[model samples]
Target chain A: MITSGDHMNWKDNLIKIAPYVAGEQPDKRDFIKLNANENPYPPAPGVIKAIEDFRGADLKKYPDANARPLMKAIAEDLGVDADNVFVGNGSDDVLALSFRAFFNSDKPIVFPDITYSFYPVWCEMLGIPYRTLPVGEDFNINAGDYNCENGGVVIANPNAPTGIGRDLSFMREILDANPGSVVISDEAYVDFGGVSALPLLREYDNLIVIRTFSKSRSMAGMRIGFAVGGDTLISALRAAKDSYNSYPLDSVAIAAGCASVADRAYFESTLKKVMATRDRLTAELRAMGFEVPDSSTNFLFAHHKSRKAADIYDFLKSRDIYVRHFRKPERISDHLRITIGTDEETDRLTAALHEYLG
Target chain B: MITSGDHMNWKDNLIKIAPYVAGEQPDKRDFIKLNANENPYPPAPGVIKAIEDFRGADLKKYPDANARPLMKAIAEDLGVDADNVFVGNGSDDVLALSFRAFFNSDKPIVFPDITYSFYPVWCEMLGIPYRTLPVGEDFNINAGDYNCENGGVVIANPNAPTGIGRDLSFMREILDANPGSVVISDEAYVDFGGVSALPLLREYDNLIVIRTFSKSRSMAGMRIGFAVGGDTLISALRAAKDSYNSYPLDSVAIAAGCASVADRAYFESTLKKVMATRDRLTAELRAMGFEVPDSSTNFLFAHHKSRKAADIYDFLKSRDIYVRHFRKPERISDHLRITIGTDEETDRLTAALHEYLG
Candidate 1:
């Protein structure tokens, strides 16, 4: 009989998967963390008030399973009805549920070759067959590449590691072509000046637009994300979420998310600051001989003319200035993705780069 | 050729699932809210301080992907190594990931017929085939019934609704029989008085013990749950979680969980109070002609001798008293699962029952 000697065989049933590695969360308190695209500003004042006013005693009960309060807040903020919104722990959770709910066909789903790293990881984890269409030579997604028979299509607007945003016209073209496929517009960084697919939701019933508070609303620690689409599509995602975990959004998150969305003034103010810093840093990197793309999001993707990107990344780390570098697919291996931080952090990073390049 | 007229064809790929319906979360503030089996007492005093002292500014940063601090706290509380712990949004999340990680064989997994309804919902959602065995007439899980060729085994000790707990000797019998499969001992209610399968972890490498903060710890709103097992089993669960959502436990939850686990005195006090209330209520219920089961959990499972449970349920709800009643699996149709609330809430529930039954 099989015992401890063969206990390892029990793992044979679990399919082997290579998990997605998130950007490093460094331990040092003084490091300039410009790796993950988290918002540089603090959350809204209302959010802080909500946390302060929150009663610890009330946590004894289960939170609302539907997350109705947060969903209503998101829907109202987006100028949509409550039925059209679906909320989750984070956008990754939202995207994962969407994949399980919509991409169920035998045909291969399609996305850009250089997109969010987690996209392929989800496909591999869920056993969904996928094909990666290469981005254009200019680091832009060509709408024509997605006009084919497929199970689903996911486009990260202002596509990651490239920071190039697509227009509503480009999104409309893809939605028009894929009449039978569900198209997910992951607008994680859309608030940073990218064109959102939300406007096309009325014209395209197959479109699902996902947004995250981690970037714009400055609540990464609270883990709030929502998806907006037609009611039918939203119901499918809701069903998928309910089936997985009934109460993914805790009470504090619901309250914090509501407070963050209600404070539009603070939100817009932070967005302006992030974009200003991103634009200023773009010019600085260019003057330093780096070929930087025009970024619509909060980060810049670039490679130096004469220096190795990995070497620059290492040098930045040595100076406690961190940035992201992807070494996969070999196409964008030479590029470094730097998240826009506060003005002070940006200045520190600039000084570090000057010292390294000299 | 498919358009809005056939737009729902996209949903065809999605398997039609009957989502699990959690207990009613009534909007009114006055309801007793005993239907969900939540703790009546507030969380540890340290937990409140942790929340009040929390820095809202730090919310812009992502939480630790590994949840190392919370994991270490739980490990110390359980007297296990940190590597043997796996944490998630809740026990439901932990169990869902475990099902995905371990229950992969073609053989149908086994559980009791009158077990947690979410178990079957998970199997249906994941496409994992399962078989249900009937518990004995006394509502006790029969260990010999699980001694069969199966893909996996799941036993909710101090079983839900029935409130019957099996001994560790019984757990050993099942574990010894299933040397080739993973055994998940869901002790969601074990803190009250139930025997734990945690001791058997040293002997059975395939055994996993799942616990929740939603019950005795009084942090249901925080959404924290964990599993303790051999390092190999825990590693597989971690890989599955990292593949799904790298940060399921947000900042507030981690802080609250760590505080709650550290306050051993407060945790034990609440447990004793709940058990005392449960025991007193059991006697009062028996005197009122209800055959109350000997419960090891914080709830009582009882059925009236002459009163129909459905009518009694409605009558009590009309008076703003809440309790759980299962309609399916005819065996438990006549019974009601009443959570042990505070002494005052207990008095109110007993009075309501007396008013109706008499």
Candidate 2:
């Protein structure tokens, strides 16, 4: 009898690193699922129609290798040439490809210590050395910290967990400082009042602005994301993507993504609603003695003045509400990242908070 | 003016290799599309129903990171526990992750020279060294060639382009020889009358049998694929997948894939039709003075007695037909890989070939 271990220590030599632990996804829908920063609203009306009208027979063929129609729509939406776009399964896929495409020098790539946890995971997966500069005391990325020499730079514009947005000027400063390295502005949450570095592509050839349909477009389940960059950088990313997985986007995703991008009015309306809810939620949390950041995303990162974040998270979970609370890095261990739910859901959440705090 | 090249030769350090060129995905429906080896029939009836019944609102939330329902369905269909199954965006993604997961040692990995082109592309992308051993004049994998020391092994059963299937004994011989390395049997075309390595899983803990919906299940546009192996190997693949893209399989893909697997009758029926078309096409090609291989897959690999493969490919294209003709690796450059289409499509293709040959 041969145990799996009887084989060579394949796990030791294999790229065995800890995988990124995604937010808890409880099966039952009864919970106010604020854990994953998912959009509260459904996808655009056109997107729903596209899904409904999708031909079942079309699925027999492979999806467009170039994801051409979807690329055209995203290009039009971003006011960029289709040649400047690269689409993938999600921003994670896009970012992974970008890491492989641009970050290759012996120098360590740099990103914020407290940004999206997946950044370091990608770096580790690709065997790229990386250094994490700490964010400011306010939990915002210090642009000056990224001016140093590196293989590349990845910044989550409106950085995750902190819900803080950075200006185009900040992005420009980083790009200007690191002309030798590729700069990726992960604008996953940019649609929710966050300024995108997309317009800066004209000035910065090294900049790649990555966006996703998961949050603002309300199509997380469809798994669509893209990067808008200079034609050269986009070409490089495409080469890497092709080498990895030629058809990352499926037919359903491509069709629904096209419809979602085309319905600009619906996209904006949902973004506005989510922003309004987030603002309201921020004020309510502050009134309850929580120090909530001025969120540029649909979620608020807050720490209570008196109550513990872990306790609040536990209480919320017990009350059938699910908000994220990271215990790592210690600095933000007391903070709770609460995704903004619908107005009614917010009301229920506030009521529950009142019961716990009062 | 900073030219795109002025800043840095990021391309030099970054992964820059010729990407695997996928078969032509022509847009117009007028052509009798036979390239890319995609299924000629539509996805299963249950898959169509699942797509129709799919809820657009669910796109707001992320897909189940574990792909629980899809995993369960595939596991049940393969008569394996859920722990033995790992799902991904496609077999390309699965194979990519598997390469990163298993083929990591300094020793070079091994595969057949005339096998799937993407295997070497993946090795290049992952920075893994690999050597290709030549298949016999029969174009069948010689399992004896894989018994030596190596990092890992990857075999495409009913191997691509050639469409020749090896029996379980062939697989057993390779597995028995390579207890120290992770052996991957990419059974992408196995459902089309090819013997699966899945049964060998109980006997060989080091073996992984990768399967895809693109070929046999007729869901190429859905981008669904899985691997059945020992629990430990599946866990490693899942870890690698999570590290790369936590949600590689989207919600729609998961739901549709489950439905496709549930309808066993439809799955078997499509396979039978494709196999029948393939058999008929082989006989017809042989009669037309083409030397064709005995194919267990939904495609036929054939070379004309006198005409050049490139010329045949061009002639077929002129008649609004598409067949794959590889230019590189000179051994098979004279052969064309033709996918099995519907009976009507096949008749048209044969008629067009007759015109070209006669």
Deviation (Å) of B129 in candidate 1? 1.2
Q: What is each predicted model's overall lDDT from 0 to 1?
A: 0.89, 0.88
Each prediction's TM-score versus the true structure: 0.98, 0.97
As a whole number from 0 to 100, the lDDT of residue B172 in candidate 1 is 95
Q: Which ten residues in a row have the lowest lDDT in candidate 2 chain B?
A: B1-10
lDDT tens digits, residues B1-358, model 1? 4455755567677647754566666668788878889999999999988888788888998998878899999999889999899889999999999998888889999999988888988898788999999998888888999877788999999899888888989999999888888999999999999999999999989899999999989989999999999987887888788778878989988988999999999999999999999999999999999998899998999899999888888998998988888888899999998999999999999999888876
Q: Per-residue lDDT for A156-206 in model 1, tens only?
A: 997998999989999999998888889999999999999999989999888
| lDDT, candidate 2, at A338 | 90
Model 2 Cα lDDT, one tens digit per residue, B103-195: 889989999999988898888888999999899988878999988778889999979889999899999999888888899999999888889
**Candidate closest to the true structure, highest DockQ:** 1
Which residue runs does candidate 1 get wrong by more than 4 Å?
A: A1-8, A19-22, B1-8, B19-22
Per-candidate count of clashing residue pairs (backbone under 3 Å) = 0, 0
Tell me what TM-score chain A of model 2 achieves: 0.96
Query: Which pairs, if any, clash in model 2?
Result: none
